[model samples]
Target: MNDPDFPRRIRDAGGRVTAARVAVLRCLAATEEPLTPDEVLERLAQTAGPVPDRVTIYRAIEWLAAHGLVRQLATVGRAARYEAVEDRETHAHFQCRGCGQTRCLPAPPPPLPPLPIGYVAERVELVIHGLCAACRAGERR
Candidate 1:
């Protein structure tokens, strides 16, 4: 994704797209998998000059998340992973117990259960945990 386009999107979302913001967005777009803030910092360091501190990354993530541009996934005993929010389908994640790898899997459409009389549901995420293919193979061995 182009930096100009990314900054434009951030501006459209009422955000100021600084170099840090563009770097973070570019890093997220480059990956097929979601990444934690530390992973994001590492990738940014390699390509985007000196990496922004974790505090800056956290602030950027908060801004992006608040503007509905990023989605966060909480893993067990680890930092949350984040991805750009271009799609909103119900999905499940396969987490490797051994290596802590997380793979996203498409899930069935959510059932429309009745909400309480005065309640509304905005969003939902269902995550499933298990061994990935490599971990499973290793277990078999």
Candidate 2:
């Protein structure tokens, strides 16, 4: 998605607005699931202009994540995936164990368990792992 506010969002997040950063953020914002750096590069290549190199895409994603403009999802021994942070209610995610496909689920995050006096919760992540519809169908065939 070509969001006109991307540049402004970067600036607001105290980051320098660059083409690679903008493109990376835009690409992530356009997708429903988090994307790896390589996936970002592939999507950018399919777009109508010069695509940033692999390193550039990595740096852009890193910068975005550092700036809190994007959130990196836990992939555990796999390529790190990133998704743009949007202004909405926090939700959970569903990951297909077979295909590694991850998608946002509308389920609200569960309430935080009680913590000790000095504890703090920065974020909540609830991931449901199972086969997606397509993967389930494939297994039946």
Candidate 3:
């Protein structure tokens, strides 16, 4: 999502684009998989200036998610991962149980078959979990 105009788009959506927000957005944009808040902070620290605290980062992530700039992945543990949404590409993720690795699967999301009559669909999320190739190979040993 190398849209140079992303900051402007965010501002147009009634959100402020701060340095911290931009850093976090950039970190997500550079990755293919969702990243937890801690991973985001570490990535931000490496690229951006000083790293923001956990609470601050979490708050920023929540705000960004609310504004549709990012989407949070459902987690089975303490930390939740997030990814940017501006790339116009939609796909599901597969979490490997054996290795704890999260991989982005290229399969298309299920069709939302139209509502009966007056109902409307807003958002949908589908996630699949299993052992990835590496994890399965390791298990065979």
Candidate 4:
């Protein structure tokens, strides 16, 4: 919807707020799990008002990621996923191998291991892959 906080977040990140950007951010924030660009487009399409094109959605996601408003996740699949980077703590993710559904886990990110000389660590992302409850149940059936 029309939360003023979305635009405010965009402006605070030093980027000009646009409809596509606000819509994309809002969609991500509304969901507990991360979503691919295609998923974002689908959700936006289901909502009221005009929906941005694929290119516009991609550009908006790129801009949001560059400005730290969204975080591009490291995924196993070809399509990259993104999640809103709000005040949430650094946590791990659980990706269902069967359904490809990714959700945030409550565990904290592990500490970085020692690196070689002149090497710098940016961030750590841990994803545990397994069959979710539904998938596992289906396997038993």
List where candidate 2 sits over 4 angstroms from the true fold: none
Candidate 4 residues 1-141, lDDT tens each? 578999999999898989999999999999899999999999999999999999999999999999998998877875889999979786899888888899998777777788999998887788888989999999998
Report the C-alpha lDDT of model 3 over 1-141, residue by residue, as the tens digit. Answer: 446666776687698887667677778878888898888888777763577787888888888888888988764665788998866767878887776667677878878777889887776677788889987898899
Q: Candidate 1: where is the Cα deviation over 4 Å?
A: 87-90, 106-118
Distance from true position, residue 47, model 3, in Å? Answer: 2.3
lDDT of 1 by residue, 57-102 (tens): 8889878878977778766857788887765664667667777877
Residue pairs of candidate 1 with colliding backbone atoms: none
| lDDT accuracy of residue 130 in candidate 3 | 84
Report how far off residue 31 is in candidate 2 (Å). 1.1
lDDT of 1: 0.77
lDDT of 2 by residue, 22-86 (tens): 99999998898888888899999999988999999999999999999899886544688889999
TM-score of 2: 0.90
Write down the TM-score for model 1.
Answer: 0.82
lDDT of 3 at 125: 72
User: Who wins the TM-score comparison?
Assistant: 2
Tell me how candidate 2 scores on lDDT.
Answer: 0.88
TM-score of 3: 0.82
What lDDT does model 3 reach?
0.78
Better of 1 and 2 by lDDT: 2
Could you tell me the lDDT of residue 53 within candidate 1?
A: 87
Worst 10 residues of 4 by lDDT: 72-81
